[model samples]
Target chain A: MIIDPSIIIIEGLKKIIESGPEFKITRFYQSNSITTNVLLHGIDILLVNPRMSKTSQFTKFIHDCRTENENMVIFALQTSYVPMQMMNLVDGVIEMDDDPSVIISKLRNVSCKTESANLSDNCELSSREKEVLVLVAKGKTNKEIAELLNLSVYTVIAHRKNITAKTNIKSVSGLTIYALLNNLISQTEMN
Target chain B: MNKFTGRNKFIELLNYNPQLILMLPRFGMKLGFGEKRVEDICEMNNVSSFMFLLLCNVYSFDDYMPTENEIKDIDANALVKYLIASHDYYLNHRLKHIEKHIGKIAKEAGKIGDVLLNFFKEYESEIATHFKTEEDTIFPYLLSENKQMIPENIDLDTLSRSHGNIGDKLSDLTNIIIKYLPAEIMPNERIGVWFDIIQLSKDLDKHTIVEEKILMPYIEGVKGGSL
Candidate 1:
């Protein structure tokens, strides 16, 4: 599913995606036309513009979308710049300038990664590590995380390093996306 | 007379470089000084007096050169913190504001808008990724007292190369906006977006230079136990 207000770009992107037989556009929606109910239907992947609507409204839309479909791989269709407001809202970003081949590969990779995260029983994160991961994903600093988790600052740092080593996601944003994909942190909790 | 001496002189420095306002809070200082001299304020905040003077010189006069004693007294950690704050200003505030302007311009451009917007987005992503590397990797390494924890392949030159690429992309976007885009629709808005891009480009260049010339060398000195 692709939801961009620009119909021209939507058509262009759709044409590009349809070039590969493996991918299909489930639905197309203008920014204003999309409602919560439409998002309730099963969607494997959703590509949306962060500025499709006002920031608050779009954030609500994302939250509702996540609530409706927990496993939907949501990628922000970056049109102008990196949307910091949408950073915690989406799983990843897919730039509009990306080649069709790159888009297809990214879609495939995200889909597979999300599926594996959901299905994998061997997620080796300890309970404390999981707690730290959630806080880190929520943008808590090491000191804040220490205070929250009742651990020393060094311990929090160590736990974070271990979490990074285990997940192989270096940055907080990457960890946030990972947490969302794996359902470790829900969209509501993120807010 | 040193320009970084009295409280009034500090206020004058702030007027000269308004962007230095962002650095005040990091030092636990604020505007509207009552009776504090620059050295006194630095002492109150536990910040190095010489380091603050060096910053004032570097920011106020582009051609200013640091004395050996001043260079020796410079704290790399403080510099890293200042750099991180500047990055926050760029990523969180300036870039977000500029993006809103670009959004308006894109809406007005119609079909060609998507192409131009995409070009800008690509550039934005590159810069975000570059900052992420510094924030996640470089800054942490510099802050950490443990030298062994520093990654073996973390070369400053390699990182600086990407900074060049970011500048190039910004220039490309600026050119595209100025030359290729149709001027009939929302010309003022388009020019406003371009102006923001230009400002960002200049700021980024200064930032890169600071990191490459000052911060990187300082870190290398510390790594070698020379600082």
Candidate 2:
């Protein structure tokens, strides 16, 4: 069976979309008719938030087009409290406030398990270790980390050990540089 | 309070003296202090306390801080306890837990997120020490009426040193989260983790506030002197 393209979200919501799923995503500008037409024909999912700056008529047109086709799953984004009745219009509503990871999980739950299958192999970093690495990347030394969390230096070193063991990047400086490159820490973090 | 993002105020304070982060080791070297002092500096700089203890106990980063022979010479259990309680229990657990569920989910999603899981492995011990430090040290000191019952070991000067390191940890962690997880549009759960991390850091800040605003004053009042 052919796997469908993961998502086609409206442009302004791209950050939310990007942060949500670790999958391939295409975006459509609010006014781009050809992009909308192509998205309707292709992607497996369409995520839109009505509160976008797009005109109501354009929004209506996109809605009409999406309603006519059932192949693509349409999700209307809402804040935490939209009326329950309005949710029936789309495949579902993803709360604007929902965790991006949660959204991805929900999408994966509905779609397929293929994406989750390979992630473990890609990084091999644990959640806490990743957190530590990200901080190391940002250039926080061991003592600073310890104090901020009310810990001693020894524990922070253990995390560094774990980070190095998993990532195969040995030095703290190297880890910091790596994190910065990976978008794990910002440049200003060196401060 | 403009949506309190979870940066450590100490690190933010250090940002004013960006050079302090670098001066740590040099100072450690200059003082000719033991592994504990170096570890304290590292702790003050936001290095992972969990990892630091492991390294000291395991003698991993032997080249930089205390030589293996030097650490071997010390009272091993006391040093180990110092490493574990001060670093792992106090710092790493809190910082890592601050990450909350979204970070957990992101870790699960990212496949490389074993850090989140490892934190669970060390959670109980870390939290125990954290609470113990406050309850055993600060609380009794603050609540004490009779001078004899109060422990001199839990003084503000000592806590302030710890606060310095913890503050640094907060700053570094905040910097990492802000860089990796930009605040554009995150899923609510991921946002929750960010918020949790922030809140936990804020809790530390509040703890410090208690030390500075409330606890310290009482201690001072009782002592009839300045901290």
Candidate 3:
């Protein structure tokens, strides 16, 4: 179960995630009216812009949201222009103006870390399986990823099957949700 | 890059209100009222009055995202450059260009241009005055206070009224631009310019809304200790 953030700003951020190669963000919000208790109960990462006035209340909101749901990652939008004193409460602070490519890469890194953390110490995801998972999070189709990863269509299908079994996501879209909640590919990743 | 020193387009585009431009910096007050700084910013940002006129024509999402090379760092220089190249520069330029053409257009289009320009002129002054107050009082005080000092008022009710007026004006200007541009005017050459303008307007609209509804009220609450 992946919970997408409800208080994300930047008008097309959700669209950017959907059109992106790595992941899709199904839920998002731009204000405090989102009722984080209800809206963020199952969300993975809360991509917040501090310049948002309601942002001041966000840390407390996140704290409360996390009391019930501990898996959420709250990433604040940091800007060089903002005084440092203003951004003390977020779990992770990412420069708001950082290039989308850099952001996506960073999200991938976080995602990878979280996914590996879920492993039972064996790192059992075969190299091929992990590669397929990465591509799936990138929002690539089995056929498209097969062409890019240089494997047969049947091999790609097998890898996806193993990934679903390991991740227990039932479907590729659900796997994407799992990837995003676990810090796989962020909505901000798409340029 | 003092290429604009004597040109008609440049002279007419000269700063009638450098104070308005001065408030544009995102962080520090780097570009004061000096001609040299203005010129530097204009050159660095590649801003011109003509570009502002072109920006009024852009309306689509494809026009919002800057080209790859245009995305730069958010440093002091870059911030100033963005204000100049993206916001104030285009705003000042467009206002002036419209001022120049509206008189002529009013004569030809009857009361249409008059109605439109009247709205623009009024809102232009309102926005300019509001921004000036922020520059002279609010922002400077925040920088100096080194601590947040809320304003006298910070409630959502006040914010809603203030923003409603400002937002409506911006919406009117945007609608006019999208509706008025003739189909034939070397539209492609102007495409890039309009894209930047639309983005600037969108960002400005969002920024002002945040400031009035969120930040201003928060500052007020902090100052008054109401929240």
Candidate 4:
């Protein structure tokens, strides 16, 4: 989504985005006020020249965009610089004179990050795995966990493999921190 | 990653994954192999190629798993020797090396630095204790000659739990350094410590899996292959 008032800037941005398979043109709104009425559910990113409109209005516009689709990434368009205040309002800034490669790479990075975050969000542990994870974090081996849970050792192993797959955390240290960070174990349980 | 065979050159292993350099010292392997094949080098070092490749696969490939035959053929003595060497290298070499570098940065950062240093010290001691448990109890029981150690707290069920305690501490140390440390305090030094921590964490994790997947099953003498 491009929200610049200038025709040349929009075309240039369009060329930049289309240069890669990573980004696409969603919808363009030359006027910031019009976007408030527009449905933004499907828009993944917004490339807007918030400077075209008043700073105060850009804030409100962005706030409205957030309510409509909070997952959407916003990149403030800048010629030389976007004010530090406005820079805080978006995920990144795209200078008008930025190399096309630079612009694409920045968007690509943000896109990959958003996707991985969604993956983590979807990776919910089953209660049994959570039980296994807390024990594993506490320092229990598979045999002990199996004995404690009254399951076969193989069953415990399967659960561990599943836990690793879902979380994509392969290391014991990684999983332990995962459990700790997720509050499955307390700070005192860190031993 | 393709499974490495005895035909693969020893130096080629490094080319395949440079991080295997860390794995080498554990197996008592040192640099200076110009063009020796894997089996040749293994034979020279008295290291089993089967065990070498299995460890290599684990270290190099993220999703590598040994076949049942591979598991059965694993040289237990060689594996244990490698693991014990790995622990020594980690404790005496890598951890101390990182501590030296991190201590310098920690002192510069003042109070927060002391806290970080102490946090690291706790982790270091915890790792020493963790490895000591295996070295003193588990290894003794596994390598028992008179079969006396098995009857005295010889059960190794607690092995998995201890592995994570140290691993998690290393990771938490990383998180604290990366997330909470003031950016004003040397960024390069912070990154230096951060990289070493991540690398060591990864190396430690690899070490854990070798014990868990290969050694644990081997220890149980479990006839059925699972996990």
Candidate 5:
């Protein structure tokens, strides 16, 4: 998504980012008010104006999207000055003056590998993915898992997606049972 | 590359994808479609050929979405009746078929099987609520004498949003059987149930696409004064 008050800038960003197969403009909002449909598409990367992305109001909306797929990446589509505190919310900034290549590269850099668009036939979960899986199985929210692992929430989400791709497990109950069966977590450890 | 129009023969359509046979009874179609074209069968069954083909497109091709104009031509009553039949088929026939097999599989597998069954039961009730919401609320709005009245509780957006997780659990169930189920416990019966789960998942997904992409858009268009 490219959330900009200016339609012209959104078009420019769409043209630049869509040049690469890595990014496709899924949704754009001229006004800061985004409908709940943002979560519906399982949107992976969000390029929103820094002003709206950091608003105390939109933060909750962004957080609500995490429930769908925690692996979502949000970037600031920078068109003006951004405070450091505001910068904290985004994965990276796509500066307004940057060339199209520069913008696409910045977007692609943060985008995780869609390793299995279709679930992998033989998904071998990484050790970190296993850690995330155990946390997930225990019914820990992504934020809690992120803190426990001493990792960014974004990275934890990426791990979570990879775990799903590998194990084909989705629901917490199923993952918990998976943990129990695989001995990743004992029965007593699960909440 | 194209949709199955009235010109297509029934035998050829079945040959194209035999799984489409599942859609027959839902549309009030029956066996022995010999030498009959799509239109002929629809006429014989008192079904709308366009609606039948529209639904066939939905079931057969993921990329096929009817335009608002195309959807406007459909009889909303026929569409509702089709959806209601689909719900009945799901909750009564398809679900019962799986439950019978899984019931035996659950008995043989013990604790894990019991846990899986309970999860499935939870999913079943959610689906019941989901469909019942449509049947009790949305269906009446379409079929009611008063066309101007907005449904009291359920809206199209809410109906679409609520469709979220009923299908998710099916994936979880299939994965649990395939990836996590102890291989030792009733492997043959387990695999049999797995097949049923997958078939139901795929059908339910198409059912959702019909509701979200076609049905909701039609009603939204109606509200926008195109009806």
Candidate 6:
């Protein structure tokens, strides 16, 4: 899905992308069409230009899209710099002036990353265990995680030990970086 | 004729390959060479003498490859900026023009079109992210004086490895459209889309080769200088 106000950009992306058969353009809409309900269409990726609107609602729209689908890959297309606050909302950012071929190459890379991450959804961690793993990855001590989850320190420790044994990644920093790359924790949350 | 110095007039070279005009606007030169030698014009326009010569030589002579001596003194930063501008032209102007025609084809194809459209979207997003990495991360690292600012895991080899075959998917799409799709709806329009794909695929392949062979190696040399 493409969500940008520029008819030219939307059309340009559609032509270059559809030229190949690997992906399709489900819908292209102006920013006004972006609502929580649009997520129901099962949009896996959204190319948006958040800078089109100066209102605070633009951020909210991005937040809503993310909330609708946690795994949906969102890319911001901007002519100049994308503000740091706006960067946090999307998976990646592309300069509007970038070569169209370069843009296509990026789509391939992100799709592969997304597919691989989805494949790992079948990993052995239970939902509770995954929760504990995320907290640990976020640099929380056992006691802090225990307080947050309302569990005893021993329980948190056990979960941490189990995560290590299961994943064979014992270092806190390793798990933290893993959580980050895997999208288990947002950069904002880490801060 | 010497590929580099033999071409005395800009108009002479422009006459050979009209497409070289694309570089003219970038160099702040307007059409009409006005009887000036390439060297004199480049100097007067504030364009790098080496760059204008190199570009003319590359574009004009078939099978002409730049020797180490040819590009040794060329400014890597200026070359990169020019490459970025080419990228901008494709993304902002050319691709958008192709897209409008695609939208028409998609609307005409009806319910069955959704599948192809979805695939295109996925491909589009992938390309966008790939460029983003280069523009936001790799390019900055190349241009910056502080090599320490680069992430520990990111080296030239790793970055090069990330340049996957984006062209394959486009080929697949072309095959599907040309060989597989039924000819019920606007067959001419479908063929037009295939042509666009072919053009884009060729352009993308050349672009990647230039980056991998020329640009990345140049940056690597610069990085070695800093270290």
Off by over 4 Å in 6: A1-191, B1-8, B11-21, B25-29, B32-37, B55-65, B69-71, B146-155, B158-163
Predicted complex 2: DockQ: 0.01
Query: Backbone collision count in every prediction?
Result: 0, 73, 16, 2, 0, 30
Candidate 1 local lDDT, A131-168, one digit each (tens) = 99999978898999999989999888777766654665
Error of 2 at B80 (Å): 30
Worst 10 residues of 3 chain B by lDDT: B54-63
Can you write out model 6's per-residue Cα lDDT over A101-140, one digit (the tens) per residue? 7888888889878665433454466677789989896778
When candidate 1 is compared with the true two-chain complex, its DockQ is 0.01
Interface RMSD (Cα, Å) for model 6: 21.3
Q: Write the per-residue lDDT of candidate 5 for residues A87-172, one digit (tens) a residue.
A: 77667788879988887777766653445442345677667778888889878899999899999998897777667667766677
List candidate 2 segments past 4 Å from native: A1-191, B1-103, B109-111, B116-128, B141-145, B148-150, B181-188, B225-227
TM-score of each: 0.49, 0.30, 0.32, 0.53, 0.69, 0.47
- lDDT (Cα) of model 1: 0.70
* Ordered list by TM-score, greatest first: 5, 4, 1, 6, 3, 2
User: Which model, 4 or 5, shows the larger lDDT?
Assistant: 5
Q: How would you encode candidate 4's per-residue C-alpha lDDT over B71-188 as one tens digit per residue?
A: 7776656776887899899999999999998898888877556656766777788888878877787676555554322455545546676675576567667766665456688788
Q: What class would a CAPRI assessor give candidate 4's docking?
A: incorrect
Indicate the docking level reached by candidate 6: incorrect
Q: Could you tell me the lDDT of residue B119 within candidate 1?
A: 57
Candidate 5's displacement at residue B178, Å, is: 1.3
- Regions of model 3 farther than 4 Å from truth: A1-13, A16-191, B1-91, B101-104, B146-149, B153-165, B177-199, B206-227
DockQ scores of all models, one per candidate? 0.01, 0.01, 0.02, 0.02, 0.28, 0.01
Best by DockQ: 5
